[model samples]
Target: MSAMTMLAVGDIVGAEAAAWLAQRLPILRDQYEIDWVMVNAENCSVTGSSPIDGFGMTTEVVDMLLTAGVDAITGGNHSWDGPDVDKVLAYPQVVRPINVSEARGQGLVTLDGAGRTLTVINMLSPTAALPGMRAPQPKPLWPSWTELAASTSLPGAIVVDLHGESPWEKASFATALDGRVSAVLGTHTHDASLRGHILPAGTGYIADLGMTGRLGFSGGGFDPAYFAAQLRGDNPHKLPAYRLATGRMTLGALLLRLDASGHTKAITRVS
Candidate 1:
């Protein structure tokens, strides 16, 4: 049996970043012999002031990713911020947070590639304390994971994207599921961690995959001026226009190689 490879990208910021990714992802795939590509697109649309208003994605951005050879797209807390939330939810290749109440999108998705099937699960950790952000904290996620495992017979390799702000939660969750899944990747923190390694059970893990967007900003796509204002106790509702960072931009992704039996063989990070 042959090995299967997959590349999972970090959070995508805006149209500019999306376009950059679309143009280059195919190249990266072929170069790395990747069988599938997954991306986090919760911030693909306009960024709003409030959590609800700021986290939606647009259909155009999703299409761009699909057209660029992305096999699946995962979303997080901001998954519902776009204009056509219903449409995004209906997409089979897109998965939203499994713990979000009344969320319209699937929490898990499966794709066939390299003569094997790969199951991808998207999850968000319980909300953490952000200095000026007000977001909902969901219930404990282990119950949801248990329920999912009981209900579904996960086939082939399993990849998980834990979008969260707390390092402790992400690390703990990944460690707990080390032997069960192929890879447990952390997203949403925007900065990549150097903690990529394979667990004792052959599962791959990372604290965060980092972000893909403009280089010199807080979260990659926000205007620094507006962000500073917010940090200064200004109203979030008075957010300034979206601004892509000047100078250079960067793309970050994690590549995983799995054996025929669905055990991780190697984990590589691409930036």
Candidate 2:
């Protein structure tokens, strides 16, 4: 039996949090002996209300993850913040799936490491946030997940990063794939959920992994005055910009002890 110490972190906003994580995550890994770490980098770049990154910070974000020894990455609506992100996705080691057609990255890949072959799949759910996009559409992401789980092409375990906004969707999908996948972790909403637990069939699950970057602020990283101005319907206030604290930023993950059959014997969410 091999223990799969997988860390599925929340959405990371910008480089500042990355800096913080570089120092903090290793400590946690040492304390827990984590084997693999994956994070949601949807907001790692500065983008407006769209899914595309306006700023070309995806490369830097990925570099930070690599430096932090993260095994892979998955993102939500903001994965396509900039055109440059497509270039980074071409690296093959990275996984980014678009619910819509013509997305840049692959939704599924296999990782062989730590005496096990782990298959990691990334998917997006069609919730209210994703307009004009259909769940399991373009190429049927959810069904693809099931197919991958049932495939014999890959050995070892399976880890899925469900990037979506709806807790219901995440939970429902997780239940559907239970016993097939080793772990089902969710991202987006910037707030961690209390729904993570080991199922009777040994599948690990969570509603969301929470946010890694600035949070509890009105805007992504704006100061109080600027946030207030925007709230008051005032014209763009030119006051000094503020980089909100990462908040009582919590890093969450499902630690599972899976046997050779990809069955989780025990699962725990590191507080």
Candidate 3:
């Protein structure tokens, strides 16, 4: 079997870290011989003000990643928050929505690498931080996956990015797709889960991929005092803050090697 390295990343926030990835990704590809790269840019384009209006992915970031040889990009609840998201989703190589609908861009993308077609699917957990989404149920989504898979026209391999909250929910999804997909990777919780391994059916699974940001402060590098103050209902003046440090970001990614039938032969997590 041919080895196709697919690097999956967690949520990315801020410009500095984006620049770093842009600079570092190509080197990693050259060294590891990575064939495909997928990143979650939901929070990267958000301004954190509202769920719909975020400023995460600037043109610079996109250009950088494109130059760095990223095969496809995926996003979550924060996709609509940014001003440029609609346009960004227009790229034929980008995977935007979690479901297959008349909604702008696509959810399933095909990457021809290492002489095989790899199907990359992006799905949002119904209970995640979606600002405005319909009812959370599997009935409507099951058909979406069925239709998307039908449209691929290739059955070499399939990888699913199950973006959502709740570990049990993510695990349930993985179990459901046990023998179907090559891998199921979770995102959006910022906190990485300890659960990751190959299922009995050959699917590689992980509860959460964690996030890409400062490693100093807890809560995925966000200001803990600010979060605590908000919880305590206190509007404290001059809240303590940590200076954003370059290269302090931690990245979580899943590297998978799949068989010709899309079964995950091996799966590994890289921090």
| Top lDDT hit | 1
Please give the distance, in angstroms, between residue 223's alpha carbon in candidate 2 and its true position after superposition: 7.3
Model 1 gets an lDDT of 0.80
lDDT of each residue in 1-271, candidate 3, tens digit only = 3556678887776666666677778877777667788887666643544233443465556667677777777776655555566677777767765563436777768887558678778887667744344212322446667776676563557888887788887787788889888888888787877657889998889888877766656746454555566558775555444233234778766677777666777777776
Candidate 1 C-alpha lDDT tens digits along 77-100: 777665788898899999988776
TM-scores of the candidates in the order shown: 0.91, 0.79, 0.84
Can you give the lDDT of residue 215 in candidate 3? 66
Clashing pairs in 1: 48-54, 56-81, 56-82
97: Cα error in model 3, Å: 2.4
List model 2 lDDT by residue over 1-271, tens digit each: 2556666777776667666676777887888777777777766665343222232246776787778877777765555555466676775667766444545677667767757677777777655234432122334557666565466464568877787778888888878878878878887666667656777787888787766655545423323564465567775535334444435544544555666777766666665
Q: Cα deviation in Å at residue 18, candidate 2?
A: 1.5
lDDT of 2: 0.64
**Clash count list over all predictions:** 3, 6, 10
